[model samples]
Target: MGKLKLLIVDDVEDNRLVLRAICKKLENFEIKEAEDGLEAVEITQDWLPDIILMDVMMPKMDGYEASKIIKNLYPQTVIIVVTAVTDPNMQKNMSEIGVDTYIHKPIDKELILFKLQSIGASIRLKQGQFKTLSKKNALNPFNSDIRSFRIIFDITDTESMMDFGMWLFDQCADKDVVACGRLDLIVELFYKLMRQGMKNQENLSIIVEESYEEIYITIKFENIIVLEPRMVDILNAFESEFIVQKNILCAKLKKYIEEKNSNFEAERTTLTEETIQEIVELKIVKEIHTAPSKERELLRQSFTQKTCAADYVSDIGGDIVDEILDLASLDEEWRERLTTFEEIPSDDNLKKFANGVLDVYAHTINSLFEFTALAYALTSLGIFLKEKAHMVVQDPAKIKTLIMLLENLGYDLVAWRKHIFELQDTLDIHYLDSSFFSSCMQIEGIMSNKEIDVDDDNDMEFF
Candidate 1:
């Protein structure tokens, strides 16, 4: 294994040297340094250190702002704030920004060693879990003949469900099928079917069949309540809505293009003939398509290029949720309101402040990495509820309502996840240095003004 990477970000050279000396005494560490938060962000873009020791107060950018961007983009990377400030408010702000731990300025060697060792052990345990899951079921999917495999398990057994899903990806890996995003899709489909009470002999079967041209998957069970008709209607409605939205977007783009062309033509008399011809050629070459029919086929081809299934599923769930949320525009209003809160009139300041508080809640949930887990948990919950509805609910209307509610909940989770991602993206993209600090200051002010007490009961919603 490669040496674990560590980055020390402090404006004071002596402080960085102190951390560096301590890290040098540690085993298997590759150390790097950055003078301030701006440099730290730049280094992280390429170096992507496993851990960062950051100073809170610095020139150009502060630790809290930098930590927010780094945590948003690389949620897995651990951050420890090494600063002189020991105020409760500072600690609370650091915690909110997703700093893993805090270390005092006058650092102790034993304390540093202990923290490093503890964090290292945790990282190793997570790695062990991944390896165990990947190697649990050693099945090969690459048999020369058309290959098929099926597994039946109780819908209530979440451990088995997760194991089977991992096993399928393991088989794909062994067979060199590169099944990351594809595996996630298969798992989601199984979860969806199971939620509709697909059970045979009190168990559901996940079947995988591979052919020369394609792989086909089926989730089946006896006496399953087939809600295909209603499902089809819902999907068709979503598709129709999507088409309408796409047409509107395309129309807007076309109008904008026409206006630009008119403006360009007005300025044509000032241009040379050759320049005009070149501009016309460039415009023709840059023809745009709002909705391409071949996009799905193109995506399939792109998937064929990936080699590792384990690596692919790592971000597929988050990516899908992000895409869905952006398309639905469910969280756009909150994002806009929070981002532009200061610009709002004093009369509307109260409402904007409330929106900002909700935005903070969204941020807090995201920093906890609850959304990803919630996505999977909701799937399991949906499946469990469907089984109950199947056995106890005699009324078809109740069953339908229950299923629809589950679907809506699933969508809501996606939207929630999407907003969190977008908020982070906005910070990373639009508020790089001073702007980032401004935003963080605003958030800190809001947080300081309110005596927000989030108890376990209130926090349960995120889970």
Candidate 2:
């Protein structure tokens, strides 16, 4: 509740005046003015501001360099880039230099106030001064010097999980620990993991450790189910481009199986000699239909040859076969059965088998998507805190590094979205549920407001 500090950095006197006027409209803000980035840095070094409204283009040193310098010195200070430059590349560059938020020129008064209020709320939350309810319960009292705590639960115990989450929040609240939304993230992650079919009796453990400088939490589980290969790809969507391609391939494979099944009865009776000759020429029977090889090279060769031969049947027939083979290899029994078959199985059986395989893959993919959505949700909260939290600010170096990771993740999410659309177009199937992408969209909604419910119990609110 102390007076929040504000630094307005702009080269133009008029621009500075405009920003100053905007800040005055908000409550309890002590304002400072700087004409350029260099002066901004100097002012920040002498007097650390809680929030800085900085213009990108300036004389001598640009806002980009100034912001970087100021952030390097004071990572806790929130920097909002106010500029007329709308070029995405420039905006991205600003983000790289540790700018937390952006406000374009011809700023609306309402937007400015909203941004200020949002940042203020985060700062108060971090400072551990923001209180949501008056009633105090006789739970464990918060301690500033406490270093660590551990809690364990049965995976199926939702009540225990909720109780633990609430207890953790209460401890932080009592201690005035500014976790920068980490508490919510931990609870949300637990919810997601539980929904992903964690074994009933498995142990889910959380360890929270704090130092004078940083607080760290780690969640662990023993006897947890391992992720399927497809799920692994989806979880790694941020780092890899193969997820969309894999999904597209899977859909095509499923369609191919369906088509082959429908035409099997007819092809069985009216098969032509030339059709047989083409099959022979493609050497499908010789290369892939023969003895199965355990060697990876042989499998790769078989996949290539079969896929190439399948191309003669349909435009993407080869790709479909390749994907089917790849998917079947995921299971040892299916791999052996597929290798031993003299010809493609009866249409009905093949269709059923392919559908079964795809169902499992889809289920795993859904779980992975849910995991990622929760991660993004957590990151969105972190992004909010990065813009607002002053207590327990992370090391400036670490914050910069995390900002880079966040930027990369944002780009990957966009790529993933575009790839999903492309897959839908190609397969005429909507593999991704609407909720998958909508969860990410919710991040923006979260950042704009202060009315999120953080307590599992209905009696208390965190913000």
Candidate 3:
């Protein structure tokens, strides 16, 4: 392929002479001269040059017609139309002829050389020898050869699926030697690796596959093991930082997920559109809600992704309602034997109430972090629900008993600490602490003025 077997075709002899003289600078490319389109077409039939430089205006047949005919007859031939015509229509017509490229005349030697070099590389790729360019050109800007390297991964536990998905996405931000790429590129790469991981049919149950222009990675697993609230909360916080914190960028989200949920089953599978949609709904949508319009649209999109998934039991089928209902309705005999009415004030009952409220409160906070009023209302409702649940085991008139039980379990401190930490991050800590202490002192003053006995049946809502 040395001295790219070049053909120079122009109606003017001087134009051909100038091009031939300049082309002599390149050690690779043997120059052949053709005057007008007809002779160029005739020469192209027997001798297949790696690239053709053709002039647009000529007698008998114009460059556009000749280029079109040559391309139609020999689709592999790379035809670059040379022209002085700047008219939009003429340029458009030349493109319609399937010219490899359009080079404006009154050419600078540097520009012509640059165009020729690009065309030479493009020709090699079209010839299905991209690997050769990769081997020869060490500094090749377009590293298209590495596009073939791809891998996939899978996780079994669907409940923790979102957690792991988000974690892997953050792995792309690793700046250390272990990290793969830029944050944006890493995420894109992770997706490709997950897709590839699904292709290998090993012991994998679920596969996350991903691929990039030069890299690919994947993970696989089966069902997820039960995770504690603290671990889940930590992962959720990282997910928030990745999406919410404007500047933080030290941790890998994927590394955190793997560490926290390593006990779960993982397997490999080809990542179809359905799998990608499930990941988006379960992982991406659950993390961020910075803007109301964006939140609403993203929620709708996630719902649509799930809804559009193929229907299959024991799999990530679309329809949240169906899954919930199936879980609740299954095991009829066990369900019928259970008592519908249970006391909520007993130790067992109070613990259940506390857990329920904690879960609902956590979910509500994660879903709508930006709205203070909404978050407060939801938390208050959770507290109210906890009271109602406790009333099942104790007299409704003796609500103070339930309050005492809740206080003894450090429920107040948990709520207070949660609010304090939440506020500390969002506002001036000193100002918030001062205001909170002042509010506490004022509440104490109000309680001190009241002559209510602790053992009495008087009921009061602190909120």
Candidate 4:
């Protein structure tokens, strides 16, 4: 694509000057200046700039009215709004008006540059060079410039969930880590819901859409989701991760693609709910989840009042898990200890491994949303390792596998903490319970050809 034609629309001369200086840092933009939203629309009618940086509190005509008029006039033009930190309603108002994105006051240069660069790349994707669906699809950006893909899968069973995950990996594996990571975050949220046995026969629809400097992962749930803060209220989730409505939950990841010779990065921005509504086109049934917390957690959530066909799967309790504390530092401690076990397979190291895992089990039990799967898996590994420390130290090869399994087990625990516990991510943690515990059983058979049973009674005996 040619250089991005950018228009900076701010009534204040100083504000326009500063934005001009920042836009100068990026070489791709062929820039312009619009004194107000009216001038912006006038310029669009005559010159048609690719992107517009609009100011909300303008004199002649405000950005809210201007953006709506321009979107209706030329649906293809991208309008990025500027909002003050003091005004809480400015962003929400702009979103309702259908502006592509909003940049907060005390404007950061890096963020603006990233946004422009991403818009430029999406323009490239729109022209039939990269992946292209029909020009009129509800999910795909249709103004001949939006870049995105959609996936619809029913989370009714394990087999379907696995297929959904593998398919997602296939589509996003080639994209950047941020792209894959953000999508994984979305999957984690879905997995937590499905693991709770909320199996609606109607498939959950997800659209991974990219806009100027931002990526949107919007999921449409078949049934209404109910969430009331039990403890800590997660604030500003709308800015970084997810903005939850009733059935449709929108999660986002910020990205800025720096064009390096031939390669480019991935990016995202906000999309109007009307656009989001096109995904499943379900009517509004308000069930709210209002949390604005620094450390995001799903204290308690459930599905309700699903109006699917009679044959369609019904709602179940989606008891989302909340973390007691961060596991990074603790997980790091065990990670180094695993390396130590590799160097010298000693009983001391073995005890450390067992205790370390058991410590995680303790945390899992105390979480508001119960996870017995984790309880059993962590306890079984910890107790079994405590008993077999002597035997494991004797065999180097067996200890190697033990160390490997332990490493994976610790990694999964932290993954749950970071992905599932902290932010929403992939559902792999659900499968990890069976897989990791089964590996622990293999360790048991290797030691004494004995079958070990794990239950609430802590009734585990060896031959």
TM-scores for every candidate against the unseen true structure:
0.30, 0.36, 0.33, 0.37
Highest-lDDT candidate = 4
What value does the lDDT take at residue 64 in candidate 1? 82
Estimate, for each residue in 100-217, the C-alpha lDDT of model 3 and write its tens digit: 4555566757546645654554444445543332222122223424211111223322222332333332232111112211232233332232333333322332222111101113
- Candidate 3 Cα misplacement greater than 4 A, ranges: 1-3, 125-144, 148-463
Stretches of candidate 2 off by over 4 Å are 131-463
Q: Of models 1 and 3, which has the larger TM-score?
A: 3
CA lDDT for candidate 4 = 0.53
Ranking by TM-score: 4, 2, 3, 1
Give all candidate RMSDs, comma-separated.
Answer: 26.0, 27.1, 23.6, 21.8
Clashes of 4: 13
Candidate 2 clash figure, as a count: 0
The residue ranges of model 4 lying beyond 4 angstroms of the native Cα positions read 129-463
Per-candidate Cα lDDT values, in order, are 0.45, 0.45, 0.41, 0.53
**Model 1 alpha-carbon drift over 4 Å, by segment:** 127-463
Candidate with more favorable, higher TM-score: 1 or 4: 4
Error of 4 at 22 (Å): 1.1
